[model samples]
Target: MELLETMLRSISAFTLMMLIARILGKSTIAQMTYHDFVAVITLGAITANLAFNNTISIRILLTSLLTFTGIAYLLMFFSMKNRKLRSWFSGKPTVLIQEGKIMESNMRKLKITLDTLNQELRGKNIFNIQEVQYAVLELNGSISVLPKPESQPVTRKDLHLKNQSEPAFPIELIMDGDIIDANLQQNDITREWLHSQIKKKGLSIENVNYAVISSNGNLYFDEYKDQIEHPVDKE
Candidate 1:
């Protein structure tokens, strides 16, 4: 049947895509470089054709996909080994802000306007340009910011506090009322402990929208409903 054929094609295409992605490692779409961008777009078009185009046979589609994957892997390997090739493939990070002053030349070269720069800065919680000590425009179109020493958050080390341990990244234990068993196991937490925490809050696991184990080994949870009380401003 035509419906079955379509379903088979869709499944095959998706499986192939996933296999290719796994082989390529975990450089997400956001982290992709100029070379990767081109390859990904071309691969997507090929995938769509594989899924829908009757003219393109599965054998040809797979061949094309494998060819592109091989090329991508080759480029990735070379880029990692060669600095010049890496720079050419990924481009270089440009200095957008230095010592609280905007570099107009670099901005113009990158085609970034003052307003756009300000917006990106604001996204990093900087309202004013003067607060930034250094800001580099990464090749992947992200800004790496360094705030002035005074503007930066005061750390425990800065206060001469000792015996402070490095924090672990928070691990998601539950999402949309479903337990993330792998994450729980990786973090060395048991389901019994999670259920106990939920019961202590006078809530059920099903009522929880999301839950995470914080760096300090605390259970942070968000219920399906908003429960915070906000004071209204009279002014």
Candidate 2:
């Protein structure tokens, strides 16, 4: 009974620690910023101590969990409330490339190398560095690529094509297993409309993976046929 009680307490502590991480913010686990590298190290240390300390009391476990959660929640709240605080907590984006030229000073300051830049560019489907008009290294450790003007694809507007209609913000009627009523309401569409469309597409709400309505009345959709879900991959 004592062993069982210890097991339960350990599980509870570990679960609470994870719950705090989730509430803190969304970040790609595959990508790590400089701050994230430190966080990973710190979390490993704390969790390792908790795991090995067999004689540790339940009070200690709960206290540590609460303290960690409270501090993170408060910091996130403050960051959201104050721009200065937000900037301090989360550094501003750095321009890695400007006007087809690498920002060497900014790159070096961020410990960014040409090889790393190339890797980031390859992830964005741009093979040639010269093709990049602007590249911003985001605080979240993702790369945003802007192609050079001549290298960019020709848009309809560039060819003097007139599109005189309000753009549609695609409504997701269903996600995973939940029906999104709020999305339908915002689009001024009814549940019945969604039901009919799903039926016409030979897809039930449960089978519908994703759906979107483009500005020009283009209906785009993807079915979540796979049981496994994946998070967004960052460069």
Candidate 3:
């Protein structure tokens, strides 16, 4: 029947889309460059037509999808290998502000207005343009701001304090009462050690909703029930 055929086509298209997404990798989902945006729109169109346009043969729809995907893959690979191709595909970062001075010509070239620039600066917690040493317009439509040295926050070095080594990233050891065995093994931590730590806190693994080893090498556990007298953000 036509209804059964439609259902089958929809399911097939959905499956193919999932496979394609995995093949394209995370960068496509995270950062949308000009090429990535165009590819996504095109892919979406193809997917929708394949799912609902029963007038078109399934073979033709699939061929279009696969051929487009193959071409995109080739372009991405070459773009990585060549600087010119990469610049053409991703576009170059433009300097909007240099040495505490606004580059009006560059801003005009990008069609960015003064109001838009101020709004972007405000988003980065910069209320005054005088505080900015450099501001760059990235390919992804984000403005990267560098504060003037005098306006920047003071660091430990400024106080002539002893420098400390950077701490390791936090590692999750348990989630929803389940132990992450791989994380434990990778970190060279034994099950017995984790159980002992939990026992010391007068709690068990089941009592923990989430647990992680902090950057400072401290074990932190969050229980399912948080005994807060008054939740400020309670809706």
Candidate 4:
């Protein structure tokens, strides 16, 4: 009887926690801001007690979980509507570098060392700090880097090439041998047309592992079997 009671309590706690997580949305799981971190730790503690502490009534544990979730939801809703509240909750971005110069004072205030700054810059694929014109520390603890104009990648405009306009985003046409009907309808691409494109490459829908309409309106296909003369990275 005791074992059955423990099993029921565990299942009940797990179900409630899953429901709470779904209600919180992706931001709660994806980005770990200071408040989000605190809330997650608190929720885990409550869940652990609710699952194993048979002495505590299930109703009281559930009420606590629901109340906390309601408060978090209200806070998120209000933060979206008000800029000041959003800033207060998530914190503001800090300018750490400007005009190829490090803001030493700001770094000191944030308790960030020179080594930490360099590490963040390297994560942005910037090995030389001299190449950076601006770097801002975001609320999510990521460093946004702007390379110096001379160090930035050259665009077609720099080469005086003719400008061509295309779709701003790529569309997936097929995945795992299945067609994306909604994408096909939205892009005005008929299934027959896509099949013909595949046939041109001497392939069929089943042969394609993935297919996409690129931003430049080019149809690209990847087959399950790849023919490579030499694989450079094969170990």
Candidate 5:
């Protein structure tokens, strides 16, 4: 009976956690703000105790979870409505670099070192800080960089070229031999058209391991039986 109770407790706690996480939306761990970080940690700690701590009552655990989630929801609601509250809770983005000049005062206030700044800059494919016109340290601890005019990627406008190309919103049509019906519907594509494309490749939908509609409306597919040599692991 004790073992059965333990199993039941684990399952219940797991289900409750999934439901609560869904309510919190899909912000990944790296994207979570300071408040979200604390909330996630607290939730995990609470859920862990609820699942494994035999002494804690299910009623108390459930109540605590619901209360915490409710409070979190309220905080989100108020923060959205009030700028001051939002600023206080979520904080604001800091200017780390502006016009090729490092904001030393802002960096010092943010407790960021020169090396750390350089490392982040390198991560953004920027080795030289002088190339950056603007660099914003986001609330989520990510650096958003705007390169200097001379360092920026050359575009069609720069070359005086016209009709370069339209934006290509590629859509995944099939994955693991399963058709993504929603994507097809979103892209206004029919299964008949897809089948016709597959025929051109001398294959069928079931033979496809993965498929995508490219920007040029071309159907690209990888057949399940296609043999391709993978690169050796470098890492």
Candidate 6:
């Protein structure tokens, strides 16, 4: 009877800890305040210790976890209910770029270096910072950018183009130098046809680094590998 009681007590503590964690949900280190993050970690560690410590009272652990969770829930609820409070806790979005100009002051405030900002801009295919109209720094420490009107690519609406056919389905061609045979067969394309295309680029299908066939029958291939030197691993 004593053994069964101990087992039941441990199981109950485990269940209680899990329930509290589930209620709190997920948030990144950048999103969570220092106090909130520390509290969550401390609560989890204490609960873990309590689970293994048979002598420590389960009531104490349960009470503390429940209290931490309840407070978190209340704070989240309050953040949602009040606009000013939400802004105060979560922070206002910082405008990094306005009217195609970089706001250096805002960037400094966010503590994000110019190199990191430029890297993100390059990922979005905006090579020149001057091309960007507005880039807002979100609370999640991510940038959302708007390109200048003059630099914006022409859309179907801009061209006055109307599509009568069904939406195009993306057809996978080559992934990491490996030809997707299933995609080729599904798209009614032959291996010989693919080889012909690769040969035109002065390469073979086996040598292709990456390629894709868009739903609109547009073939994009990147066969030539540019050698990038890495100081850490390079001889």
Predicted candidate 1: what Cα RMSD to the true structure? Answer: 15.1
lDDT (C-alpha, whole model) for all candidates: 0.82, 0.69, 0.83, 0.81, 0.81, 0.71
Can you write out model 2's per-residue Cα lDDT over 83-118, one digit (the tens) per residue?
557668767778898767899999889899999999
Off by over 4 Å in 5: 28-30, 161-235
Tens digit of lDDT per residue, candidate 6, span 3-98? Answer: 776677668767876676566655523466433566668777777756566676777877776777777767766765665576676777788887
Q: Candidate 3, residues 2-51: lDDT per residue as tens digits? A: 88888998999899988988888777777677887888888889999998
Candidate 6: TM-score? 0.52
Best by lDDT: 3
Residue 218, candidate 3: C-alpha displacement in angstroms: 33
Q: How much is the lDDT of residue 213 in candidate 1?
A: 75
Clashes per prediction? 0, 2, 0, 0, 0, 0
| TM-scores, each model vs. reference | 0.66, 0.59, 0.64, 0.63, 0.64, 0.52
* Candidate 2 TM-score, C-alpha based: 0.59
lDDT score for residue 103 of model 4: 95
lDDT of 5 at 126: 94
Q: Return the candidate ranking by TM-score, descending.
A: 1, 5, 3, 4, 2, 6
Q: How many backbone clashes does candidate 5 have?
A: 0
Scanning candidate 4 in windows of ten residues, the lowest lDDT window is: 161-170
* Best of the two (2, 4) by lDDT: 4
As for TM-score, the candidate ahead, 1 or 6, is 1
TM accuracy, model 3:
0.64
* Ranking of models by lDDT: 3, 1, 4, 5, 6, 2
Worst 10 residues of 5 by lDDT: 161-170
Better candidate by lDDT, 3 or 4? 3
lDDT of 4 by residue, 28-75 (tens): 787666667777788888888888898889888888877877877777
Candidate 6: the clashing residue pairs are none
For model 2, where is the 10-residue window of minimal lDDT? 162-171
